[model samples]
Target chain A: MCEANVYLIDKEGNEKLLLESVDKLVPSDESIMLENIFSQRKTVKARIKEMALVEHRIVLEEKD
Target chain B: MCEANVYLIDKEGNEKLLLESVDKLVPSDESIMLENIFSQRKTVKARIKEMALVEHRIVLEEKD
Candidate 1:
């Protein structure tokens, strides 16, 4: 499965796991839409920070 | 090979492919670090917009 675990990065460079087994990412206005294999969804005002695909990791930093 | 193809989302909601076969994403102070399987790297001043792991896709929106 190519699904990745999503993380949120803070200003202090700290990371927090936000979602797991995410299957879709859609961009809307100033936020991102996240959907998982189970069809769970979340919309957050953030940007793409990093993606560690091989490691099944993705990161996001809060927008100002 | 969990790497994903990265895309940039514009204000108009258009998607542009930015990188392919990306394996790593690191967040610096204000930019995202991208690395592919070939070890090529790019730093983009953006935030994490989305991650569609099932489709091997990731998206980013520019930060203002």
Candidate 2:
């Protein structure tokens, strides 16, 4: 599966896993929506911080 | 292939195709790196504007 693992990164450079095996990501307004292959969905108020597509890792920065 | 098509979105909300069938994306210092399944590589000074993973569309905002 090309689905990616999502993480939340804080200003201090700490990373926290947000979701696993996420198959889809949609941006809406100021938030991002994540959907897994199983159709499980989640929404986070954050912005794209960094991405390593080949590594299936996506980092996000939470909005204040 | 699971690679995504990359686009550059301007402040006016206009979209411009940057790359096609990109298989990997990596963030560096002040740029984002793109690599295709064929190992083609490119670097752009931009930030993620939005992403539609299921649609294989990745939007980016060019840095000024």
Candidate 3:
């Protein structure tokens, strides 16, 4: 199975974001394809938007 | 910040398990306290030991 923990850091550098125990990883393209599927779930979509790779951490740092 | 896309399958039919785009999500006690902060790296510890969670799709099916 796939379990992922999603987190985010806003422009304020505050780490108030923390998604405990995810179960899948949707690709960018697939994410887009599934946008409609996930549109209603803004939280999930937002989490997907804040997705990036950072030293094997898969970080989602807010860009200015 | 974190993203995660991990998949696995071994012990029956095939379905092209894919780990397209992962960002982060490693719990289980901080992945067992980082597992020595790094130990020869064994396939991300067998993909976190096939974490189980249906529906969402964190699957690593391989059992006898």
Candidate 4:
């Protein structure tokens, strides 16, 4: 239940799914490293726009 | 285990504890509404700096 699906909001205010089951977010150099339950990993250059943990949804900043 | 302790980063890069055992984060108008296990609620105007869910730590943006 701690895991969340990460979404990237576009300039048009649309949500684009980015990652799933994200269990960890580590801040890297100008980016955030996301690690999921299946051990999948990716780095994203965005801040959190919103965190709806209870809903298992995490909205990230708009794309650059 | 899904609950997290929220912290706000100060201008000096110091962490100031804001909320504990927070389980929900709802995006409001220019603010985020946080709700804890104890039913305590608060609204904060900031973006996410980091989310170390495995460590139960949620670091928010610095003060405006």
Please report the candidate that would top lDDT against the real structure: 1
Q: Is candidate 1 or candidate 4 better by lDDT?
A: 1
User: Over the stretch B1-64, how does candidate 2's per-residue lDDT look in tens digits?
Assistant: 4668899877777888989888777656488888877788889998766676667788888776
lDDT, candidate 3, B1-64, per-residue tens? 2223346565554644445334334333122111112121213322233322223334333334
| lDDT by residue for model 1 (A1-64), tens | 8988888886777889888998887766587788889899887887777567888876778676
lDDT of candidate 4 over B1-64, digit per residue (tens): 5788999887788789999989887654377788988899998886666787767788877546
Instruction: State in Å the error of residue B37, model 4.
Output: 4.0
Candidate 4 off by > 4 Å = A12-14, A26-32, A45-47, B12-16, B26-33, B45-47
Q: Model 1: DockQ against the native?
A: 0.51
Q: Go through the candidates in order and give each one's C-alpha lDDT.
A: 0.80, 0.79, 0.34, 0.78
Candidate 4's residue-wise lDDT over A1-64, tens digit each?
5788999877788878999999888754467788888899988886566676766778877546
Clashing pairs in 1: A47-B47, A47-B48, A47-B49, A48-B47, A48-B48, A48-B49, A49-B48
iRMS of each prediction in angstroms? Answer: 2.8, 3.3, 10.5, 3.3
DockQ values of all predictions: 0.51, 0.36, 0.12, 0.41
Residue B58 in model 3: lDDT:
40
